[model samples]
Target: MTLFIGIVIFLVTFVFMEFMAWFSHKYIMHGFLWVLHKDHHHKDHDSWFERNDAFFIIYAVVSMSFIITASNTWFWYGLPIGFGIMAYGAAYFLVHDIFIHQRFKLLRNANNWYARGVRRAHKIHHKHLGKEEGECFGMLFVPFKYFKK
Candidate 1:
Protein backbone atom coordinates (compact mmCIF):
# COMPACT_ATOMS: atom_id res chain seq x y z
CA MET A 1 0.00 0.00 0.00
CA THR A 2 2.74 2.43 0.92
CA LEU A 3 4.76 1.75 -2.25
CA PHE A 4 1.71 1.95 -4.47
CA ILE A 5 0.79 5.20 -2.88
CA GLY A 6 4.29 6.54 -3.42
CA ILE A 7 4.20 5.74 -7.12
CA VAL A 8 0.82 7.38 -7.52
CA ILE A 9 2.08 10.39 -5.68
CA PHE A 10 5.10 10.61 -7.92
CA LEU A 11 3.08 10.76 -11.12
CA VAL A 12 0.62 13.29 -9.75
CA THR A 13 3.46 15.30 -8.32
CA PHE A 14 5.12 15.58 -11.73
CA VAL A 15 2.06 17.30 -13.14
CA PHE A 16 1.68 19.52 -10.12
CA MET A 17 5.36 20.41 -10.26
CA GLU A 18 5.06 21.46 -13.89
CA PHE A 19 2.11 23.68 -13.10
CA MET A 20 3.84 25.14 -10.07
CA ALA A 21 6.87 25.84 -12.20
CA TRP A 22 4.75 27.80 -14.63
CA PHE A 23 2.94 29.75 -11.93
CA SER A 24 5.97 30.63 -9.84
CA HIS A 25 8.11 31.60 -12.80
CA LYS A 26 5.34 33.62 -14.43
CA TYR A 27 4.20 35.41 -11.29
CA ILE A 28 6.58 35.09 -8.37
CA MET A 29 10.14 34.87 -9.77
CA HIS A 30 9.59 37.31 -12.61
CA GLY A 31 7.18 39.40 -10.57
CA PHE A 32 7.87 41.15 -7.26
CA LEU A 33 10.33 38.54 -6.00
CA TRP A 34 12.72 39.31 -8.85
CA VAL A 35 14.39 41.62 -6.36
CA LEU A 36 15.99 38.60 -4.73
CA HIS A 37 16.40 36.63 -7.96
CA LYS A 38 18.06 39.66 -9.50
CA ASP A 39 21.01 39.08 -7.22
CA HIS A 40 21.56 35.83 -9.06
CA HIS A 41 22.02 37.68 -12.33
CA HIS A 42 23.85 40.78 -11.07
CA LYS A 43 26.33 39.34 -8.58
CA ASP A 44 29.82 38.71 -9.87
CA HIS A 45 30.14 35.75 -7.52
CA ASP A 46 27.46 33.60 -5.91
CA SER A 47 27.59 32.42 -2.33
CA TRP A 48 25.60 29.42 -1.08
CA PHE A 49 22.45 31.51 -0.61
CA GLU A 50 23.04 34.46 -2.92
CA ARG A 51 22.13 32.24 -5.83
CA ASN A 52 18.58 32.71 -4.58
CA ASP A 53 18.00 28.97 -4.83
CA ALA A 54 16.65 28.80 -1.33
CA PHE A 55 13.14 29.23 -2.69
CA PHE A 56 12.89 25.43 -2.70
CA ILE A 57 13.33 25.26 1.06
CA ILE A 58 9.71 26.22 1.52
CA TYR A 59 8.59 23.63 -1.00
CA ALA A 60 10.66 20.90 0.62
CA VAL A 61 9.23 21.56 4.05
CA VAL A 62 5.65 21.62 2.83
CA SER A 63 6.10 18.44 0.77
CA MET A 64 7.80 16.63 3.63
CA SER A 65 4.82 17.31 5.79
CA PHE A 66 2.56 15.60 3.31
CA ILE A 67 4.86 12.60 2.81
CA ILE A 68 5.14 12.05 6.52
CA THR A 69 1.40 11.99 6.95
CA ALA A 70 0.47 10.16 3.75
CA SER A 71 -1.24 7.07 5.23
CA ASN A 72 -4.59 8.45 4.24
CA THR A 73 -5.57 9.42 0.68
CA TRP A 74 -5.89 12.99 1.85
CA PHE A 75 -2.31 12.90 2.93
CA TRP A 76 -1.42 10.99 -0.22
CA TYR A 77 -2.44 14.04 -2.17
CA GLY A 78 0.57 15.71 -0.72
CA LEU A 79 2.82 13.06 -2.24
CA PRO A 80 2.34 14.43 -5.72
CA ILE A 81 2.32 17.99 -4.42
CA GLY A 82 5.61 17.45 -2.68
CA PHE A 83 7.09 15.57 -5.61
CA GLY A 84 6.06 18.37 -7.95
CA ILE A 85 7.73 20.99 -5.80
CA MET A 86 10.91 18.96 -5.58
CA ALA A 87 10.80 18.39 -9.31
CA TYR A 88 10.68 22.13 -9.86
CA GLY A 89 13.60 22.61 -7.54
CA ALA A 90 15.57 19.91 -9.26
CA ALA A 91 14.73 21.31 -12.67
CA TYR A 92 15.71 24.78 -11.55
CA PHE A 93 18.90 23.55 -9.98
CA LEU A 94 19.89 21.45 -12.95
CA VAL A 95 18.79 23.81 -15.68
CA HIS A 96 19.48 27.24 -14.21
CA ASP A 97 22.44 26.51 -11.99
CA ILE A 98 23.93 23.85 -14.20
CA PHE A 99 23.16 24.79 -17.80
CA ILE A 100 21.85 28.32 -18.35
CA HIS A 101 23.65 30.37 -15.72
CA GLN A 102 26.60 27.99 -15.37
CA ARG A 103 26.80 28.81 -11.70
CA PHE A 104 27.84 25.21 -11.04
CA LYS A 105 29.05 24.38 -14.49
CA LEU A 106 31.63 21.92 -13.28
CA LEU A 107 28.92 19.35 -12.66
CA ARG A 108 27.50 19.88 -16.16
CA ASN A 109 29.07 18.09 -19.09
CA ALA A 110 26.63 17.61 -21.92
CA ASN A 111 24.34 19.84 -23.96
CA ASN A 112 21.34 17.76 -24.96
CA TRP A 113 18.27 18.90 -26.84
CA TYR A 114 16.26 19.91 -23.78
CA ALA A 115 19.25 21.53 -22.18
CA ARG A 116 19.98 23.54 -25.31
CA GLY A 117 16.36 24.60 -25.57
CA VAL A 118 16.13 25.65 -21.95
CA ARG A 119 19.43 27.49 -22.09
CA ARG A 120 18.39 29.39 -25.17
CA ALA A 121 14.99 30.15 -23.72
CA HIS A 122 16.42 31.47 -20.48
CA LYS A 123 19.05 33.43 -22.35
CA ILE A 124 16.34 35.14 -24.29
CA HIS A 125 14.54 35.88 -21.05
CA HIS A 126 17.66 37.43 -19.56
CA LYS A 127 18.32 39.54 -22.65
CA HIS A 128 14.85 41.08 -22.54
CA LEU A 129 13.94 44.12 -20.47
CA GLY A 130 11.95 43.78 -17.26
CA LYS A 131 8.62 44.28 -18.99
CA GLU A 132 9.45 41.62 -21.54
CA GLU A 133 10.10 38.76 -19.13
CA GLY A 134 6.87 37.08 -20.14
CA GLU A 135 8.34 35.07 -23.02
CA CYS A 136 9.76 32.06 -21.20
CA PHE A 137 7.28 31.52 -18.40
CA GLY A 138 7.12 27.75 -18.79
CA MET A 139 10.36 26.23 -17.69
CA LEU A 140 10.47 22.62 -18.96
CA PHE A 141 8.26 22.85 -22.03
CA VAL A 142 8.55 26.26 -23.62
CA PRO A 143 8.44 26.87 -27.36
CA PHE A 144 11.51 28.51 -28.88
CA LYS A 145 9.53 31.06 -30.82
CA TYR A 146 8.18 32.49 -27.61
CA PHE A 147 11.59 33.96 -26.99
CA LYS A 148 12.49 34.59 -30.65
CA LYS A 149 10.24 37.66 -30.73
Candidate 2:
Protein backbone atom coordinates (compact mmCIF):
# COMPACT_ATOMS: atom_id res chain seq x y z
CA MET A 1 0.00 0.00 0.00
CA THR A 2 2.89 2.35 0.60
CA LEU A 3 3.96 2.07 -3.03
CA PHE A 4 0.44 2.84 -4.19
CA ILE A 5 0.28 5.83 -1.89
CA GLY A 6 3.58 7.08 -3.29
CA ILE A 7 2.29 6.79 -6.83
CA VAL A 8 -0.83 8.70 -5.90
CA ILE A 9 1.21 11.39 -4.24
CA PHE A 10 3.40 11.68 -7.30
CA LEU A 11 0.41 12.09 -9.62
CA VAL A 12 -1.10 14.67 -7.29
CA THR A 13 2.15 16.59 -7.15
CA PHE A 14 2.46 16.48 -10.91
CA VAL A 15 -1.03 17.94 -11.32
CA PHE A 16 -0.44 20.54 -8.63
CA MET A 17 2.67 21.79 -10.39
CA GLU A 18 0.44 23.18 -13.15
CA PHE A 19 -1.16 25.56 -10.71
CA MET A 20 2.23 26.38 -9.29
CA ALA A 21 3.54 27.14 -12.75
CA TRP A 22 0.61 29.39 -13.55
CA PHE A 23 0.83 31.19 -10.23
CA SER A 24 4.54 31.72 -10.43
CA HIS A 25 4.38 32.90 -14.03
CA LYS A 26 1.52 35.33 -13.39
CA TYR A 27 2.85 36.70 -10.13
CA ILE A 28 6.57 36.20 -9.73
CA MET A 29 7.80 36.10 -13.35
CA HIS A 30 5.63 39.02 -14.43
CA GLY A 31 5.85 40.76 -11.10
CA PHE A 32 8.94 42.11 -9.38
CA LEU A 33 11.16 39.51 -11.02
CA TRP A 34 10.34 40.76 -14.50
CA VAL A 35 13.90 41.91 -14.76
CA LEU A 36 14.94 38.29 -15.00
CA HIS A 37 12.05 37.11 -17.16
CA LYS A 38 11.84 40.06 -19.56
CA ASP A 39 14.58 38.90 -21.86
CA HIS A 40 12.66 35.70 -22.47
CA HIS A 41 9.94 37.69 -24.18
CA HIS A 42 12.27 40.25 -25.74
CA LYS A 43 15.47 39.26 -27.52
CA ASP A 44 17.97 41.66 -26.01
CA HIS A 45 20.85 39.21 -25.69
CA ASP A 46 22.85 37.55 -28.42
CA SER A 47 23.45 34.47 -26.29
CA TRP A 48 21.04 31.57 -26.51
CA PHE A 49 20.72 31.50 -22.75
CA GLU A 50 18.68 34.03 -20.80
CA ARG A 51 18.67 35.11 -17.18
CA ASN A 52 15.19 33.62 -17.06
CA ASP A 53 16.86 30.19 -17.10
CA ALA A 54 17.57 30.79 -13.45
CA PHE A 55 14.00 29.82 -12.71
CA PHE A 56 14.73 26.31 -13.96
CA ILE A 57 17.74 26.11 -11.71
CA ILE A 58 15.66 27.19 -8.77
CA TYR A 59 13.12 24.46 -9.43
CA ALA A 60 15.83 21.87 -9.94
CA VAL A 61 17.29 22.70 -6.59
CA VAL A 62 13.89 22.42 -4.94
CA SER A 63 13.27 19.05 -6.56
CA MET A 64 16.74 17.82 -5.61
CA SER A 65 16.18 18.80 -2.03
CA PHE A 66 13.13 16.58 -1.88
CA ILE A 67 15.02 13.69 -3.46
CA ILE A 68 17.84 14.09 -0.98
CA THR A 69 15.38 13.96 1.87
CA ALA A 70 13.98 10.65 0.71
CA SER A 71 16.72 8.85 2.65
CA ASN A 72 15.27 10.19 5.85
CA THR A 73 11.93 9.56 7.57
CA TRP A 74 10.12 11.37 4.74
CA PHE A 75 11.29 8.85 2.15
CA TRP A 76 7.90 7.66 0.97
CA TYR A 77 6.48 11.09 0.28
CA GLY A 78 9.71 12.82 -0.60
CA LEU A 79 10.68 10.37 -3.31
CA PRO A 80 7.41 10.74 -5.15
CA ILE A 81 7.27 14.50 -4.73
CA GLY A 82 10.80 14.88 -5.99
CA PHE A 83 10.23 12.76 -9.08
CA GLY A 84 6.94 14.51 -9.75
CA ILE A 85 8.48 17.95 -9.64
CA MET A 86 11.35 16.85 -11.84
CA ALA A 87 8.94 15.29 -14.34
CA TYR A 88 6.88 18.45 -14.52
CA GLY A 89 10.01 20.50 -15.01
CA ALA A 90 11.06 18.26 -17.86
CA ALA A 91 7.66 18.58 -19.52
CA TYR A 92 7.73 22.34 -19.12
CA PHE A 93 11.16 22.51 -20.70
CA LEU A 94 10.18 20.35 -23.66
CA VAL A 95 6.88 22.12 -24.32
CA HIS A 96 7.79 25.72 -23.55
CA ASP A 97 11.36 25.76 -24.75
CA ILE A 98 11.72 23.22 -27.50
CA PHE A 99 8.23 22.80 -28.96
CA ILE A 100 6.79 26.27 -28.51
CA HIS A 101 9.85 28.49 -28.79
CA GLN A 102 11.86 26.25 -31.08
CA ARG A 103 14.88 26.58 -28.83
CA PHE A 104 16.16 23.13 -29.80
CA LYS A 105 14.62 22.99 -33.28
CA LEU A 106 12.89 19.68 -32.46
CA LEU A 107 9.17 18.92 -32.18
CA ARG A 108 8.42 21.74 -34.58
CA ASN A 109 6.41 19.51 -36.87
CA ALA A 110 3.72 18.67 -34.31
CA ASN A 111 0.59 20.13 -35.90
CA ASN A 112 -2.23 18.41 -34.05
CA TRP A 113 -5.07 20.31 -32.47
CA TYR A 114 -3.51 20.26 -29.01
CA ALA A 115 -0.13 21.27 -30.32
CA ARG A 116 -1.67 24.04 -32.42
CA GLY A 117 -3.63 25.29 -29.45
CA VAL A 118 -0.61 25.37 -27.20
CA ARG A 119 1.41 27.16 -29.84
CA ARG A 120 -1.42 29.62 -30.47
CA ALA A 121 -1.81 30.39 -26.80
CA HIS A 122 1.88 30.91 -26.34
CA LYS A 123 2.00 33.12 -29.38
CA ILE A 124 -0.75 35.26 -27.94
CA HIS A 125 1.13 35.48 -24.67
CA HIS A 126 4.31 36.47 -26.46
CA LYS A 127 2.51 39.08 -28.56
CA HIS A 128 3.04 41.41 -25.63
CA LEU A 129 6.71 42.18 -25.25
CA GLY A 130 6.31 43.87 -21.95
CA LYS A 131 5.66 41.84 -18.81
CA GLU A 132 2.67 43.94 -17.75
CA GLU A 133 0.47 43.06 -20.73
CA GLY A 134 1.46 39.43 -21.37
CA GLU A 135 -1.06 36.73 -20.62
CA CYS A 136 0.14 33.89 -18.36
CA PHE A 137 -0.82 30.26 -18.77
CA GLY A 138 0.62 26.96 -17.61
CA MET A 139 2.66 24.96 -20.07
CA LEU A 140 0.11 22.16 -20.30
CA PHE A 141 -3.10 24.10 -19.70
CA VAL A 142 -3.75 26.56 -22.48
CA PRO A 143 -7.20 28.17 -22.41
CA PHE A 144 -10.08 26.39 -24.16
CA LYS A 145 -10.75 29.35 -26.40
CA TYR A 146 -7.29 29.00 -27.86
CA PHE A 147 -8.14 25.43 -28.92
CA LYS A 148 -10.32 26.39 -31.86
CA LYS A 149 -11.27 23.89 -34.57
Candidate 3:
Protein backbone atom coordinates (compact mmCIF):
# COMPACT_ATOMS: atom_id res chain seq x y z
CA MET A 1 0.00 0.00 0.00
CA THR A 2 2.78 2.40 0.87
CA LEU A 3 4.69 1.66 -2.32
CA PHE A 4 1.61 2.08 -4.48
CA ILE A 5 0.81 5.31 -2.72
CA GLY A 6 4.32 6.61 -3.19
CA ILE A 7 4.31 5.86 -6.90
CA VAL A 8 0.95 7.49 -7.35
CA ILE A 9 2.12 10.49 -5.38
CA PHE A 10 5.21 10.89 -7.55
CA LEU A 11 3.35 10.70 -10.85
CA VAL A 12 0.56 13.08 -9.90
CA THR A 13 3.04 15.47 -8.38
CA PHE A 14 5.11 15.36 -11.56
CA VAL A 15 2.18 16.46 -13.71
CA PHE A 16 1.12 19.20 -11.36
CA MET A 17 4.69 20.42 -11.20
CA GLU A 18 4.95 20.64 -14.98
CA PHE A 19 1.81 22.70 -15.24
CA MET A 20 2.93 24.88 -12.39
CA ALA A 21 6.31 25.34 -14.09
CA TRP A 22 4.66 26.48 -17.30
CA PHE A 23 2.15 28.73 -15.61
CA SER A 24 4.66 30.32 -13.29
CA HIS A 25 7.22 30.76 -16.04
CA LYS A 26 4.68 32.38 -18.31
CA TYR A 27 2.98 34.60 -15.77
CA ILE A 28 5.00 35.01 -12.61
CA MET A 29 8.56 34.97 -13.98
CA HIS A 30 7.61 36.96 -17.03
CA GLY A 31 4.82 38.88 -15.44
CA PHE A 32 4.83 41.52 -12.73
CA LEU A 33 7.19 39.42 -10.64
CA TRP A 34 10.16 40.03 -12.97
CA VAL A 35 11.83 42.19 -10.34
CA LEU A 36 12.57 39.14 -8.26
CA HIS A 37 13.53 37.04 -11.27
CA LYS A 38 15.69 39.77 -12.81
CA ASP A 39 18.30 39.12 -10.21
CA HIS A 40 18.86 35.71 -11.76
CA HIS A 41 19.94 37.31 -15.04
CA HIS A 42 22.12 40.26 -14.09
CA LYS A 43 23.44 39.80 -10.58
CA ASP A 44 27.17 39.18 -10.27
CA HIS A 45 27.15 35.52 -9.37
CA ASP A 46 25.76 35.24 -5.87
CA SER A 47 25.23 32.27 -3.57
CA TRP A 48 22.83 29.64 -4.84
CA PHE A 49 20.35 30.67 -2.18
CA GLU A 50 20.76 34.36 -2.95
CA ARG A 51 18.91 34.16 -6.28
CA ASN A 52 15.20 34.95 -6.32
CA ASP A 53 14.32 31.35 -5.94
CA ALA A 54 12.00 31.97 -3.03
CA PHE A 55 8.97 31.09 -5.09
CA PHE A 56 9.95 27.48 -4.76
CA ILE A 57 10.08 27.90 -1.02
CA ILE A 58 6.59 29.33 -0.92
CA TYR A 59 5.37 26.56 -3.20
CA ALA A 60 6.98 23.84 -1.12
CA VAL A 61 5.48 25.10 2.11
CA VAL A 62 1.97 25.43 0.74
CA SER A 63 2.05 22.18 -1.19
CA MET A 64 3.64 20.23 1.62
CA SER A 65 1.06 21.41 4.12
CA PHE A 66 -1.79 20.61 1.81
CA ILE A 67 -0.35 17.24 0.96
CA ILE A 68 0.24 16.27 4.56
CA THR A 69 -3.24 17.33 5.60
CA ALA A 70 -4.81 15.63 2.63
CA SER A 71 -2.81 12.45 3.16
CA ASN A 72 -3.84 12.20 6.79
CA THR A 73 -7.49 12.94 6.10
CA TRP A 74 -8.27 11.99 2.51
CA PHE A 75 -5.59 9.26 2.32
CA TRP A 76 -3.76 8.67 -1.01
CA TYR A 77 -4.97 11.62 -3.06
CA GLY A 78 -2.46 13.99 -1.53
CA LEU A 79 0.48 11.72 -2.16
CA PRO A 80 0.53 12.15 -5.92
CA ILE A 81 -0.15 15.85 -5.81
CA GLY A 82 2.66 16.51 -3.38
CA PHE A 83 5.08 14.33 -5.26
CA GLY A 84 4.15 16.00 -8.53
CA ILE A 85 5.05 19.42 -7.18
CA MET A 86 8.37 18.09 -5.93
CA ALA A 87 9.18 16.57 -9.29
CA TYR A 88 8.51 19.91 -10.95
CA GLY A 89 10.88 21.64 -8.57
CA ALA A 90 13.57 19.09 -9.32
CA ALA A 91 13.08 19.58 -13.05
CA TYR A 92 13.25 23.33 -12.67
CA PHE A 93 16.45 23.05 -10.68
CA LEU A 94 18.08 20.92 -13.32
CA VAL A 95 16.79 22.71 -16.38
CA HIS A 96 16.79 26.26 -15.11
CA ASP A 97 19.71 26.47 -12.72
CA ILE A 98 21.98 23.80 -14.10
CA PHE A 99 21.76 23.45 -17.86
CA ILE A 100 20.10 26.63 -19.07
CA HIS A 101 22.23 28.99 -17.06
CA GLN A 102 25.37 26.89 -17.31
CA ARG A 103 25.65 27.08 -13.55
CA PHE A 104 26.15 23.33 -13.34
CA LYS A 105 28.68 22.90 -16.11
CA LEU A 106 29.70 19.34 -15.40
CA LEU A 107 27.41 18.11 -18.18
CA ARG A 108 28.26 20.89 -20.64
CA ASN A 109 30.01 18.73 -23.17
CA ALA A 110 28.72 19.50 -26.65
CA ASN A 111 28.00 15.80 -27.14
CA ASN A 112 25.44 15.54 -24.40
CA TRP A 113 21.81 15.90 -25.40
CA TYR A 114 20.59 17.74 -22.30
CA ALA A 115 23.53 20.11 -22.46
CA ARG A 116 22.92 20.84 -26.11
CA GLY A 117 19.17 21.31 -25.90
CA VAL A 118 19.06 23.44 -22.77
CA ARG A 119 22.14 25.48 -23.66
CA ARG A 120 20.95 26.15 -27.17
CA ALA A 121 17.47 27.13 -26.13
CA HIS A 122 18.80 29.33 -23.42
CA LYS A 123 21.27 30.95 -25.80
CA ILE A 124 18.50 31.68 -28.25
CA HIS A 125 16.43 33.05 -25.43
CA HIS A 126 19.25 35.32 -24.43
CA LYS A 127 19.90 36.32 -28.01
CA HIS A 128 16.81 38.44 -28.07
CA LEU A 129 16.33 41.27 -25.62
CA GLY A 130 12.61 41.90 -25.65
CA LYS A 131 11.27 38.40 -26.29
CA GLU A 132 13.26 36.01 -24.17
CA GLU A 133 13.90 38.39 -21.22
CA GLY A 134 15.11 36.08 -18.42
CA GLU A 135 14.26 32.43 -18.36
CA CYS A 136 12.91 30.81 -21.49
CA PHE A 137 9.48 30.85 -19.87
CA GLY A 138 9.10 27.28 -21.10
CA MET A 139 10.60 25.30 -18.27
CA LEU A 140 12.65 22.22 -19.23
CA PHE A 141 11.17 21.76 -22.65
CA VAL A 142 11.03 24.64 -25.12
CA PRO A 143 9.85 23.30 -28.45
CA PHE A 144 11.13 25.13 -31.52
CA LYS A 145 7.55 25.88 -32.38
CA TYR A 146 7.47 28.37 -29.54
CA PHE A 147 10.28 30.44 -31.04
CA LYS A 148 8.67 30.63 -34.45
CA LYS A 149 8.23 34.15 -35.79
lDDT of each: 0.66, 0.92, 0.66
- Which residue pairs in candidate 3 collide? 9-79, 9-80, 13-83, 13-84, 14-84
lDDT string for model 1 (1-149, tens) is 87787777687777667677777766877787876566655564636567456566766787677766665656656666666567767876776676666666464666676666676777677775463345545666678554432
- In model 1, the worst 10-residue window by lDDT is 128-137
Residue-level lDDT tens digits of model 2 in 98-148 = 998889989978999999999999999999999887888997778899898
The most accurate candidate by TM-score is 2
Q: Residue 2 lDDT in model 1?
A: 78
Q: In terms of TM-score, how similar is model 3 to the real structure?
A: 0.71
Over 4 Å off in model 2, which ranges? Answer: none
Backbone clash count, each prediction separately: 1, 0, 5
TM-score of each: 0.72, 0.96, 0.71
Please, what's the RMSD in Å of model 1? 3.8
Clashing pairs in 1: 13-80
Model 1 misplacement above 4 A = 1-6, 44-48, 71-74, 129-134, 144-149
Q: What are the per-model C-alpha RMSD values against the true structure?
A: 3.8, 1.0, 4.1
Residue-level lDDT for 135 in candidate 2: 89
Residue-pair clash count for candidate 3: 5
